[model samples]
Target: MLTTLLYSPQDNSLIQGDDSHIAQWQQSDDAILWLNIDGELTEPLQAMLKQTFNLHQLALQDASRDRHPPKIEDFGDHTFILLRGLSADSESINCDNILLAMFISERFIITRHSARSLSIERTMAALHAGDISLATGTGALSLKISRFVVKRYHKILFDLETRLEQLESVMLTTADDKVLAEVVLYKTDLTRLRRNFHYHVELFNNLRDEPSLPFDSALAHEINDVCEHQHRAASLADLFYQVASDLIDGYISISAHRLNNIMKVLTIITAIFVPLTFIAGIYGMNFEYIPELKNPYGYFIVWGVMLCITAVLIWLFRRRKWI
Candidate 1:
């Protein structure tokens, strides 16, 4: 869908317009126009962008690409910005990042995104409600939208931290394979989150050097705020990933130590039975000339010997603290 909100700085009035008179509206310099294009960039839409906004071909091409990280391109007449907005999936571990493309010029701002965004909706609602307190200049509007996107990141980071804490709690109660799998899954998510926010840091830094936007000082300050936010989010992600990894390792080490103790106990039991088994085997051997076969008390003597051997083994094991 294509949505447009035009704000006249002179009268402080806001009005929504259709695509039919967009080109005519662009001819006016008295108002700041915000054109938001959502969904795929069809050929006709691309043509409209070219004819109405005079956007460069390369910039349009970059915007149309299916996948691109956050970046900025200075096209002399205007500047194009590509940003990532995170959308968390509560039902599952996997999350998504929506790509937002924007063009900022002297009198107009164009925003394009493949998916619905909270920032866009909020800004539109504010504009429709005639909230002119926000500066309608292209630079300020872009900064506002960027700030909203960063706010979303803050929520995602908080969720990540909460998940890690919960996982750690569960891990302490049970050190099992299922818990380990969850730890690894959360680690993967943290890694991806860090990568996504890292790219935003670079994009915001580039925005700071942007020469096309108006009000350099204000724009730079806003960009710096975004940079700081991205840095904080990325750092949190890194810390969470490391914590998850350490938890997994600790659980595995505990499991290994438990198994080793079990094996040691079994080994001690087998050692105590070896000599007893040998004595039984000798008495059971079929030999006609065996001297014990002619003796009446041979059975009692062998029984006493076997008992002694068992008692000696037990005493030795106890003394050595191997039981």
Candidate 2:
């Protein structure tokens, strides 16, 4: 689907239309157009992008890909940026990512994504609600959308931190396989997030340090702010990954300690029973020359001896605090 929003600041009017309005929007020099392409990029849409925006063929190819790392490129006339955004229908922890490919120039910004994007939706809402003014130029509007994307990472990181804390508490009270599995999953997810955020950090840093077009100092500051946010998101992801690792390690240590205690108890029981078993073995011998077996009170004596032995072993264990 193609949705276009054209804002003409001179007349102070907003026009919402489809692909047909592109030619009309392009005729006005002061009009700022935002073209949003959702889902797969069809041939006609691709053709429109190539013809209308004069986007590079390579950039269009990268934009059409299902998976691409977050990056920024300068094509002299326009800036091409590929960012990772969260899918609208997924949870924060186990959410899927959608690529938000943008071709931004002075007067227009084109965004393409394979799936619905929360960041794009929020930005469009802001534009419609008059919270974000298109008169600010496409660069600032793109930054606003990038900021929204970074905010999603912040939310995910917060959820991850909360879940890790809960897992820590659960580890203390119980040793469940499910919790371990979940921690591993979180670790894996955080690893991926950290890598992606790292790329985003680089992308924003590059955009800030060397922009495609010479932006004013105010726009440069906004880029710096977004870069800092990306850094924080990446750092948080790395930290949470370590937390997940520690939880797994702690769980293993707890399980080992429990196993060791059980083994120690079994060892102690065996130590106490070994000698008793020896005496019983000797008394059960069928040799006719056994003198103790001839005694009338032999069975009672054996019982008393066994009880005394048991008492001694119990006292010894108590003194050593092995229990």
What is every candidate's alpha-carbon RMSD to the true fold?
2.8, 1.7
Candidate 2 per-residue lDDT, tens place, 90-190, comes to: 66778799999998988889999999898998999998898988888889999999999989889878987888898899998898999999999998888
Per-residue lDDT, model 2, residue 50, is 88
Q: Which stretches of candidate 1 lie over 4 Å from their true place?
A: 88-93, 129-136, 209-212, 289-323
lDDT of 2: 0.89
Model 2, residue 92: distance off in Å is: 2.8
Q: After superposition, how far is residue 144 of candidate 1 from its true place, in Å?
A: 2.1
The models' CA-based lDDT, in order, is 0.78, 0.89
Please list the residue runs of candidate 2 whose C-alpha ends up more than 4 Å from where it truly belongs after superposition: none
Please report the candidate that would top lDDT against the real structure: 2
Worst 10 residues of 2 by lDDT: 209-218
- Best-performing candidate as measured by TM-score: 2
